[model samples]
Target: MAATIPIGPYHVALKEPIFLKLEVEGERIKDADIKLGYHHRGIEYLAMRRTYWQNIFLFERVCGICSDAHTTCYCQTVEDVAGVTPPERALFLRVLVAELERIHSHLLWLGVAMHIIGFDTLFMQIWRDREYVQDLLEIITGNRVNYAYNTIGGVRRDVDEKTIRLVKKYMDTIKNAFDKTVEAILQDPVIEARVKGVGVLTHEEAKRYGVVGPTARASRIASDIRKDDPYAAYDRLDWEMIVFDEGDVLAKTLVRVYEVYESIKMVNESLEKLPPGPIVTEVSRFPPGEAFGRVEAPRGELVYYIKSNGTNVPERVKVRTPSFMNIASVKPMLLEETIADAPLIFASVDPCVACTERVIIVDSRTNEKKIMTFNEFMIRYGRKRK
Candidate 1:
C-alpha cells in the first residue's frame, strides 16, 4: 500500500500558508506537490482601477519583504514607457535603499532558518540586528517597510549629508555584526550537521528551470540581475557577486550571508559617491507601448511587464517574483530527504510568497478541493495525524 503524509496548507514550519502535499514512504519524501495562488490579492488586476502614482504604492504592498524590489521594478518600467531618466543621484539612492533592504531580508531569512532548526536564540539575535537596517531605511525614505521611495521618474526623497553620515555609521556597525553572525552560522557544529550536504541542487538543474537568486548562485549559476544588467547604481559601485559551487543548503545560506556584506559595501560606496540633484522627475504622460523591468530582489530577480495605452493608468501590469521561480525547485529537492530536513531545505530558497504578490491556486485530482488558513491547516493536520 502507498503511504502519504499531508503537510500544510498549514504547518508550524511554514511562516505563511502554503500547501505542500508530500508523498512519503519510510520517512523519505517520494513526492512534494505544491499548491500556490491561495493568497492572490489581484494587485495587478487593480492596475486598471487606479492611477500610475497610486499603483506604485499598491505594487509595493504585493510583497512586504520584497516591497522595495517591486517599487524598483515599477519605477524602471514607468521610466521606460515615459521616456524619462531619473537624476543620477536618484538612481544612486535607489541602489542604496535596495541594498539596505536586501540586508534586512537576508538577515530575516537567516533567522527563519535558525528558528526552523530549533535555534530561537540565533533567530532572535539576527532579527534584532536586522532592525538597524529598517531604522536606517526609515530615515532615508520616511517609512521602514513600504518606503514609497521609488516614484515614477525617480526616488521620492534625496539622501542628505546628515542622513548619509548616519547610514555610514550604521553600515560600519552593521557590517561588523553581520560578519560575526555569518562566522557563527558557518562555524556552528549543529548548523553543519543539519545543513551541510543536505538538499543539493546541481548547477545544470538550477539553470534549466531558470532559477534566480542565491538558490541558483549556490549551484554556481552566477546569475545576478544587478551585475548582468548594471541597473541603478550597481554599475558605479565597486563590488562582486558571491557564488558557490556546492548546490547545498549550506551553500545557499553562505551565499545569502556573504551577500549581506556585498550589499553593505555597495550601499556605502553609493553613499560616499552620491551625487546632488532632484530625486524625482515629473512624468505627466506615458507613450503607448510596452516596457519591461527587472530588479535583483532579496530572493532573486524580480521582473515587471507593463503595457501602456497612452494614459496615466497602465493597461496591463504583470510581475514575476523570484520566489515564484525558486519555489519550483523545492519539489525536486524534497525527493529522498527526511521530513525533519524539509523546513531547512524549504527555507534555503527563502520563498517569499508575499514577495510575488501572487494568488494561491489549489487543484486536486480527487473530488475534494478546499482552501484553509495557515491556522486552519495546522489544526486540521494535527487532528488528522492524531
Candidate 2:
C-alpha cells in the first residue's frame, strides 16, 4: 500500500505557499500532484482599472523577486501598442538594472539552495556577497528590490558617472570572488553526493514540459528568449547561454552559478557601450492594438500580452510566468525518487509560487453571499485529507 504525504502550501522546506501531494511506498515516491492558488491578487483585472502608466507600478508587484522583469516586460508590451521607442541610453540603463537584478536574484537562489542543503555557512556567505549587488542597485535606481527604474517610454532614472564607475567596481568584485565561490560548491563531496544525479530531467522532458531558465538550460535545451528573440539591449550585447547535459540538481546549480558571470559581463559591456540621449519620449495616446512582450528574467522567459482599445486603460492583460511553465515538470521528476530528494528536486527549479498563484470562479445565476476562512473553503471544496 502507498501512503500519501503533503509537503506544502506551507512546510519547512518550502518558503512560499504551494502544496505537493506525494504518494509514496516507504521512502520512494510513486506519484505526485501539485496545487497552487493559495494567494491571488487579481493583477489582470487591476490592470484594466488603472491607466497604462499606473499599471506599470501594479505589474511590478506581481513577483517581488522579479519585479523589475515584470515591469520591464509590461512596459515593453505597452510600448509596442503605443508605438513608442525608448531612447538608446534608456535601453542600456534598463539592461543594466535588469542584469543587476539577475545577480541579486540568482544569489538569493544560491543562498536558499545552500540553506535547503543544510549548509548554513555558505548560505550566509552568499547572501553577504549579494549585498554588494543590492547596494549597486540602490545607488543607481534609488531603491533596492522593486527599483521602479523602468517606465513606459523609457527608464525613470539615469546612471551617473559615479554610479557607472561603482558598477564596474562591483562587477570586478564579483569576478574576483567567482572562482572561489564556485570551487566551494562544486568541489565539496557532500554537495556532489546530494545533487550530482538527483532529479534528472531529460532534454525531451524539458521540451515537453516547456521548462525555461536555468532548469531548461541545465537539461541542455539551450532555449533563451534573449538569444532567440533579442529584447532590450541584448541585441547589442554578446554572451553565451550556459548549458549542461546532466539535467540534475548540480547541473542546475552550475548553470546559474556561471550565469552570474555572464550577467556581470553584459552589465559591464552595456556600460562601456552606453549611449547618451533622452531617457524617455513623449507618449500621446495608445491606439487600439495588441502587443506581446517577452523578457529572459532571472528565472526564465517571462511573457506579457496586452490589448488596447484606443483608451488609457488596457482592454486585457495576461502574464505567462516561467515558474508556471516549470512547476508542472516537478510531477515527472518526482516519480520513483525518494521522499528525501523531493524538496531538493522542487527547489532545483527555483519555483516561484508568487508568480503562479491565481484563482477564478464564475456563477451564472445570481450574486452569492458567503464568506469563509481558507480552511473552511478548503474543506468545502473537498480537499480534506484522509
Candidate 3:
C-alpha cells in the first residue's frame, strides 16, 4: 500500500506557498505532483492598467530575489518597443547591480538549502556573509532587496568613484569569506552524504524539461541567457559559465557556489571598466508594436513581452519567469527520492513560486471554463461607472 504525503500550500520546509503531492511506498517516493497559483497577483492585468514607468515598480514585486532582473527585462522590452538603447555606462551599471543581486540571491538560496538539510550552523554563517553583499547593494542601489535600479532607457542611478571603490573593497571581502564557506560545504561529510547521488536529473532530462540557469548548467547544459543572448554589459564583460556533469543536488550546490565567484569577478570588471556617459536616454513616444526581452536571472532566464499602442501605457504585458521552467523539472527530480529528501531536492531548484503564478478562474455554476486575455478580462469583469 502506498501513502500520499502532502507538503505545502504552506509547510515548514517551503519558502513560499506551493502544494506538493508525494505518493510514497515505504520511504521511497513513487510519484510526485506540484501545484502552483496560490500566490498569483494578476500582475499582467495590473501592468496593462499602469503606465510603462509605473510597471517597472510593479514587475519588481514579482519576486524579491529576482526584483532587479524583472525590471531589467521589463525596461529592456519597453525600450525595444520604443526603439531606444541605454547608454554604455548605464549598461555597465545595470550589469553591476545585476551581478550583485545574483550574489545575494545565490547566498540566500544556499542558506535556505543548508537549513533544509538541518545544517543550521552553516545556514547562520552563510546568511551572515550574505549581509556583506546586501550592504554593497545598499551602497549602490540605496535598497538591499528591491533595488529600483533600472529604468526605461537605462539605470536610475550612477556609480561614483567612491561607490566603485566600495564595491571593490566589498567584493574582496565577500569572495574571501565565500571561498572558505564553499570549501567547508564541499568537504563536509554529512552534506556530501546527504546531497550526492540524490535528486538526479541527467543532462538529457535537463534538456528535455527545458530547465534553465544553474539547474541547466549543473546538468552540463551550458544554457545561460547572459551567454546565449548578450544583454547589458554581459557581452563586453569577461566571465565563464560554470557547469557540472553530476546533475545531482550536490552538483547544483557546486554550480551556484562557483557562479558566486564568477559574479564577483564580473562585478569587479564592470566597475574597473565602467565607462563615462549619461545613464538614461529620453524617449518621447512608444510606437505601436510588440517586443520581447529576457535576462539570465539568479534562478534562470526571465522573459517579458510588451505590446504598445502608441501610448504611455502598454497594451499588453506578459511575463514568463524562469521558475515556471525550473519548477516543472522538480517533478522529474522528486520521483524515486525518499520523502525525507523531498524538501532538499525541491529546494535545490531555488524555486520562486510567487514569480511563477498565472491565474485562471472557472465559473462553478455552469462548469464553464474560458481562457481570457488581459483585455477580455478587463472589459468583461472590470469595474464600470456611469
Candidate 4:
C-alpha cells in the first residue's frame, strides 16, 4: 500500500511557502506533486500601476537573493523600450555587483543545504565566509541586500578607486576562506555518502524539463545565459561556464562551488577593467512599445517584459523567474528517492517561492478578471474559526 506525505505549505526545511505532495510505498517516493501560489504579492500588477522609476524598487523586492538581477533586467527592459543604453562604465559596474551577489547567493544556498543535512558546523563556516561577500556588497552598493544601485539608464553610484581596492581586498579574503571550506566539504565522508547518488536527474530529463542555473549545469546541460547571450561586461570578461555530467546532488554541489570561484574571478576582472566616464545615461521620457530583458541571476535566467504606453507608467509588466521553471523539475527528481532525502533534494534546487508566486483570479462564466491584495483575498475567503 502507498501513502501520501506532505512537506511544507510551512516546514522548517522550506525557506518560503510551498506545498509538496509525495506518494510513497515503503520508504521510497513513488510520485511527487508541487503546489505554489502561497506567497503571491501581485508584483506584476503593482509594476503596471507604478511609474517606471518606481518599478525598479518594486521589482527589486521580487526576490531578496536576486534583487540586483531583478532591477538589472527591469532597467534593461525599460531602457530597451525607451531606446536608451547605459554608459560603458555602468555596464562593467553592473557586472561587478552582479557577480558579488552571485557569490553571496550561492554561499547562502550552500549553507542552508548543509544545515538541512544536519551538518551545522559546515553550515556555520560557509555562512561566516558569506558574510565577507555581504560586507563587500555593502561597501560597493551601499546596501547589502536591496542595493538600489541600478536605475533607468545606468547605475546610481560610481565605484571609486578606494572602493575598488576594498573589493579586491575582500575578494581575496573570501576566496581563501571559501577554498578551505570547499576542501572541508569535499573531504567529509558523511556528506559524500549522503549526497553522491541521491536525487538523480539525468541529462535527458534536465533538457526535457528545461531547468536552468547550477541545476541544469550539474546535469551536463551547458546552458548559461551569460555565455549564451552575452550582456553587461560578461562578453568582455574571460570566464568559463561550470558544467558537470553526474546530474546528482554531488554534481549540483560541485557546480555551485566551482561557480563561486568563477564569480569571484569575474568580479576581480570587472574591477581591473572598470573604465572611466559617466555612470548613467539620462532619459526623461519613455516611448510606446514593448521590450523584453533577461539576466543570469544567481538562481538562473530571470526574464522581464515591459510594455510602455508613451507615459511615465507601464501598460503591462510580466516576470518569469528561474524558480518558476526549476520547481516543476523537482517532481522528476523526487521520484524513487527516499522520504528521508526529500528535504535535501528539494533544497538542492534553492527554490525561492516568493519569486515564483503570482496570482490573477478570473471568473468562469463571465470571463471577468480581478487582481486582489493579500488582505482583501484573505478577508473574503478566510475560513471561519470556531
Candidate 5:
C-alpha cells in the first residue's frame, strides 16, 4: 500500500516554506506534488504603482539573495522603455556586482546543501569563505544583500582603483581556498554515496521541463543566458559556461562550483577593462511601448517585462524569477527516489519560493468563490477617509 507524506509549508528539511506532497510505498516515492504561493509579497503589483526609479529598490527586495539580479533585469527593461544607454564604465560596474552576487549565491547554496546532507563542517567552511564575496559586495554597493546599486539609466556607484585591487586580492583568496575545498568535497565518500546517480534529470527531461541555470547545465544542456542572449557586459567579457552530463545532485554541485571560478574571472576582467566615464545618465521620460529584459541570475534566467504609457509609473510590470522556472523540474527529480534524499534533491536547484509567487485570497464566507486581485484588495482596504 502507498501512503502520502507531506513535507512543509514548514518542515525540518526546508529552508523556506514550500509544501511537498509525496506518495510513498515503503521507502520509495511514487510521485510528488509542490505547493507554492506561501511566501508571495505582491511585488509585481507594487512595481506598477512605483515610478521607474523607485521600482529598482522595490524589485530588489523581491528576493533578498538575488536582489541585484532582480534590480539589474528591472533596470534593463526600464532602460529599454526609456531608450537610455548607461555609460561604458557603468556597464562594467554592473557586471562586476552581478558576478559577485552570483558567487555569494552559489556559495550560500553549497553551505545549505552541505547542512542538508549532514555535512555541517563543510557548511561552516563554505559560509566562512562566502563572507569574502559578501564583504566585497558591501564595499562596492554600500549594502550586503540589497545593494540598490542599479538604476534605469545607469549604475548608482563608481569603482575606484583601491576597489579594483581589493577585488583581485579577494579573488586570489578564493582561488587559494577553492581547490582544496573542491578536493575535499569530491574525495569525500559520504557525498559521493549520497549524491551520485541520485535525482537524475536526463537531458531530454531537462529540455521538456524547461529547467535553467546550473541545474540545466548539469544535465548537459549548455543553456546560459549570458552566452545565448548576451546582456550588460557579458558579451565583451570572456568566460566559459560549465556543463556536466550526469544530471544528478553531484553534477549540480560541480556545475555551481566551477561557475564560481568563472564568475570571479569575469569580475576581474571587467574591473581591469572598466572604462572611465559617468555612471548615471539623464532620461527625460519613458515612451509608450513595451520591452523585455533578462539576466543570467545565480539560480537561472531572471526575466522582466514592462509596459509604459509616457508616465513616471509603469503601465504593467511582470517579473519571471529563475526559481519559478526551476521549481517545476523538481517534481520529476523527486520521483522514484527515497524519502531520505528528498530534501537535498530539492535544495539542489537553490529554490527560492519568496521570489516566485504572490497572494490570491478567495472569499469562502458565502461560498461565492471570488478570487481577489492584489490591486482590488488594496484599494478596498486602503480607501481614504471622506
Candidate 6:
C-alpha cells in the first residue's frame, strides 16, 4: 500500500512561483494536486476596461516568454471583429516574427530543463547560445520579452535589407548551435537516462486530456493549430508537422529540438519568400461582435475568445492557454509514477504557469458564484480535466 505526500503550493526548486501539490506514495506519485491562481492577473476582466488598441499591448504582457503568441491571438480576434485581412507582406512578416519567438522560447526552455536536471554546464552553454536569438529579436523588435511588435491589422516594424541580412546570419548561427545541442542530448547517455521514457502519455490519453504542442505531438497527436487551423502566413507556408509516438520526456524534448530546426527553416523560407509591401495598416475603429482566435504557440494551441459590443473597448476577453489545457494531463500521468520522476513528467507538458490560462463565465438563472481549479472540478465531475 502507498501513503500520500504533498509537495507544493511552495517549493525551493521552482524559479516560477506557481503552487503545485504532489501526492506521493513512497517513491511513486499517487496523484498530483496543482494549486493555481497564484499568477492570475485577471487580464481578461481588465480587457473590458481598455480600448481595443490598448488591449493589444496589455494582452501581450500575459506571458513574457510567449508574448508574440498572445499578441497574435489578440490581433487576430480584433481583425476578425473588424473583418480585415492583413496584406501578404504583413502576414509574412508576422510569420517571421512568430517563428523567431518560437525558437527563442524553446531555447530558453531547453536551458531551463538542463538546469533542472543538474546539467549546469549544458544550461550555461544553451543560454549563452540563446543570446544570439535574443539579440536578433531585440534588433528587429526593439524590446526582447514583450515585443509590443504586433498591432491590429499588421506588424509595427518593417524589415529592411540590412536588417534582413543580419537576421539571416543570426538564424544560421543559432541553427548550427541547435543542431549541436540536439546531438549532445541524443548521444549522451546521461541525458538519455534523464529524459527517455521517464514519463509516458499514450496517444489516446493525450487526446483525452487535450494535450497540445510538443507534449501532444510526443504522444502522436497531430493537433498543431497552425496545421489544423491556418492563420496568417501559415496557410501559405510549406512545412510538415512533427509528431512522435513514444510520448515521454525525451520525446517532448526531441520535438522541441526538431522544432527549433523547423522554425529555422521557417525563418529562412520567410526571408526567401519575403513579399513586397508595407508592414502596417492603420485603422482607428473596429466593428464589434464575437470572434474566436487560435494560434500555434511555442507551447501549443492557444485559444482566445473575444466579445465586442460595437465599442472601442471589448466587452469580454477569454483565454484558454495551451499550458492550461496541457497541464490537465499531469494528474493522470503522475499516477503510479516514481516521485523523483514527477518533475520530468510535469516538464513534459511544457506549461508556463504564469501565462497559462484565464477564464470567466456567468449563469443566466441564479448568477451563482463559482471559482474552482479545473482539475478539482474534473475529478469531482468524474471526467479528466482539460
- In the predicted model 3, the residue pairs found to clash are none
Q: Which candidate achieves the best TM-score against the true structure?
A: 3
Model 4 lDDT tens row, 1-386:
99999998999999898999999999899999888878878787687678999888998899999899999999999999999999999999999999999999999999999999999998999999999988888988899899999999999989899998888999899999998999988999999999999999999999999999899999999989999988888999999999999999999999999999999999999989989999999999999999988899999998888888898999878899999889888988899999989999998888989988867677899999787664565467783111
Q: After TM-score superposition, what is the CA distance of residue 194 in candidate 6 from its true location, in Å? A: 1.7
Which tens-of-lDDT digit does each residue in 317-381 have in candidate 3? 88999989999999889898899899999999999999888766679999886666655666787
Better of 5 and 6 by TM-score: 5
What's the lDDT for candidate 4? 0.91
lDDT of each: 0.85, 0.89, 0.92, 0.91, 0.90, 0.82
* lDDT (10s digit) by residue, model 1, range 263-375: 99988899888888778888888889999899999999989998888988787788888988999898778889998888788888898765543433245666566655434
- C-alpha lDDT (0 to 100) for residue 197 of candidate 1: 87
- Poorly placed runs, candidate 4 (over 4 Å): 360-386
**RMSD list, candidates in order:** 7.2, 6.1, 2.0, 5.1, 2.8, 5.7
Candidate number with greatest lDDT: 3
Score residue 16 of candidate 2 by CA lDDT: 92
Candidate 1 C-alpha error for residue 305, in Å: 0.8
lDDT of 2 by residue, 64-178 (tens): 8889999999998999999999889988988898898999999999888888888999989888889999899889989888888899989998888988898899889977776
Better of 1 and 4 by TM-score: 4
Candidate no. 5 TM-score:
0.94
Rank order (by TM-score, best first): 3, 5, 4, 2, 1, 6
Candidate 2: RMSD to truth: 6.1
Between 2 and 5, whose lDDT is larger? 5
Q: Which residue runs does candidate 3 get wrong by more than 4 Å?
A: 363-386
Worst 10 residues of 1 by lDDT: 354-363
